[model samples]
Target: MYYPGQEAQLRAAMAESEAFRQQIEANHARGPAEPSAAPAGSTADSSSGASGGVQTQECPRCHGSGQCNGCEGTGHKDVTDAVSGQMGEKKYSSEMCRTCGGSGKCQLCGGKGRTLPIW
Candidate 1:
């Protein structure tokens, strides 16, 4: 919430914004989080692949957090819907991110969320 007329609300909002910024900085300094295990319904996106072998790497995009740069880690994206029968473009819609394959993981790392050595 923002209120230019209300000084108190504005101050509170500023403080909250500052706190959030600090938190984000801290998170970045610590680096992206690692995946301890697998994702739902897909071994290929997990620590193990279809062959049952470990397939992981530090996400270059998310620094090993398994988030897609295209969607900022969100597996889905909000898009403007097509025009209706009468109306023009409609509201936003969500769909799986093609880059990350809806797993919010680094395709290179197989969503393991671990930064590995370069080959």
Candidate 2:
């Protein structure tokens, strides 16, 4: 038989653990919902191949802005570069482009500035 107090403590601990698990699951399910507009050098599209592959556009997460704060409109936080070890301002601007958001696209042709015949 278990002690009365011991059972209560165990139950409380289990409840706390479950709550934490749910929080983590919820976080993982939600992801950034924007396009990143950082320079091409800072990003890459590995899935895109020669013939056919996933098209890589700006990171919607950053909205092409490289700072993390949505209010600030930047996709990165203010921190020293790991490699350079230098202090610098990292941020993204929303003034990029209303249409392509700085990607320079008509959306109809994926920024090609031209549309193909739908034949």
Candidate 3:
């Protein structure tokens, strides 16, 4: 047995899910890239290199995950209520970890939290 509007809702949900999956796939395709190295003869410190060097550390704000913290990496924050089609304050519920994509690892360090020397 099916309801009149149920099918439409189901289809909409499916479409939204597919769209989200595609977006996630596209994002994951980019993958994690190695940080660029500093110019030759640069005297950057052993820890936290200079501006020339690539950002070896993950973003504290996004945790190198490149997703919003308030939204739990969903990018879209929840709204408690709507007024005349207007949105309210942003909110969020539990979701997969953006840093490791729920793997619970540091993407920059690949969960190692540190990079190995080129040598």
Best by TM-score: 1
lDDT of 3 by residue, 5-90 (tens): 69988889899999999987776576434334443322223454423333243334444455444444453434455555656655
lDDT of 2 by residue, 1-119 (tens): 56776988888989999999998677546632333633342333344452322234443444444433323322222333556654473443435544344444334444332222222
Q: Which regions in candidate 3 have their CA more than 4 angstroms from the true location?
A: 1-4, 33-119
> TM-score of each candidate?
0.35, 0.26, 0.27
lDDT per residue as tens, model 1, 5-31: 899877888999999999977765664
Per-residue error at 54 for model 3, in Å? Answer: 18
* Candidate order, lDDT descending: 1, 3, 2
Compared with the true structure, all predictions reach lDDT values of: 0.59, 0.44, 0.50
True lDDT of residue 11, candidate 1: 84
Question: Between prediction 1 and prediction 3, which has the larger lDDT?
Answer: 1
